[model samples]
Target: MLKITDLHVQLEEEDKKILKGVNLTVETGKVHAIMGPNGSGKSTLSYVLSGREGYEVTQGSAELDGEEILEMDPEERAAAGLFLAFQYPVEIPGVGNMTFLRTAVNAQRKARGQEEMSATDFLKEVRAKAKSLKIDADMLKRPVNVGFSGGEKKRNEILQMAMLEPRMCILDETDSGLDVDAMKLVADGVNALRDEGRSFLVITHYQRLLDHIKPDVVHIMADGRIIKTGGPELALEVENNGYADLLEGTA
Candidate 1:
């Protein structure tokens, strides 16, 4: 569903490059796990794919189902069936979670030439999805991610993904700060969304989360490049031996 080829990226104000010729393809009905140490440009790939500003694409192309997404704005990307569950979800103090989600969902539907959902319909659908994700109704009525715990925030992101139903979803460090229970909740939400026409790129450092989601392909990224690709066993190997051996050989 997504293809990234020879993707090179650098911060505009800095001379240093982050991603150097990184390439990968995620097909529909599969999940890809990108495991890398800190500063490996894993998050950069997510940001660049989502069209965040300040990251210059020196060379490369990211295509979603044969359409180039590098030229699209962030909202356009979302409307084109791309979703990014951030590593650290931002808090919008004044925006209630329900209000924010309804706005986003309606906006995407409106862009697609569909009529906006009525408040009652949106509430019913969102409540069902949120309940499936184990998000409390009270949380939905509060400000987005404001005063929420780390696990709560991650669960909220998953709730958004479930509500959005994007064709390709990128989960960046969704397990970063969650407790075991929260991790399971987040993983369950992702698993529930997995299907034949959708794909996921899960960026994480630990193998624990993969045990629940079970990625179809595992990739090891370093120095802004994907140096190794393997099956689920690769994640176990990395967990057991760390990135040392992979880095030594690649270096």
Candidate 2:
């Protein structure tokens, strides 16, 4: 569902390049995990694909379902079925979570030339989805991510994903700062959304998350490029051996 070819990105204000020729293809219904050490540009790839600012794509293309997305705005990318779960989900102090969710959903629908979901239908659907994610009614009434615990924040992100139902999801360190139980809860939410029409690009530093959300393909990235590609065992290999061994000849 998503294809990236020869992607080259650099800081807009400086000459430091983050991603150099990143080529990846995520088929519909597949889960692809990207593992690398610090500063490997995994998160940068996610931001670039989602059309975040301050990073310029000097070369290459990121296409979602055969259409180029690099030229589109961030909101346009969302309407095109691209979602990015931030590493640190930001807090919106005044906006209730429900209000934010409903507005976002309706906006995307409108952008896609579909009718907005009615208030009754939206409330029912959101409540059901929130229940599945273990999000309480009180949490929904609160401002987005404000006063939420680490796990609660992560679960809220999954709730957004569930409501949006994006075709391609990019998770940038969703496991960070999450406890064991929290990680599993978030993973369950993610697994619940997996289907024939959806795909996931999970960028994480540890293999423990993969134990819960088993990826079909695992990639080791270093020096702004994907250095190795393997199956699930590759993650375990990195866990046991560390990137030291993997970095051998990568320089």
Q: Please give the TM-score that candidate 2 achieves against the real structure.
A: 0.99
Candidate 1's residue-wise lDDT over 1-251, tens digit each?
99999999999889889999999999998999999999999999999999899999999999999999999999999999999999999999999999999999999998888899999999999989989887889999999999999999999999999888899999998999999999999999999999999999999999999999999999999999999999999999999999999899888
Q: Which candidate is the best by lDDT?
A: 2
Q: In every candidate, how many clashes are there? A: 0, 0
Estimate the TM-score of every prediction: 0.99, 0.99
Model 1 misplaced stretches (Cα beyond 4 Å): none
Off by over 4 Å in 2: none
RMSD of each: 0.7, 0.6
Clashing pairs in 2: none
- Error at 40, model 2, angstroms: 0.5
List model 2 lDDT by residue over 1-251, tens digit each.
99999999999999999999999999999999999999999999999999989999999999999999999999999999999999999999999999999999999999999999999999999999999999999999999999999999999999999999999999999999999999999999999999989999999999999999999999999989999999999999999999999999576
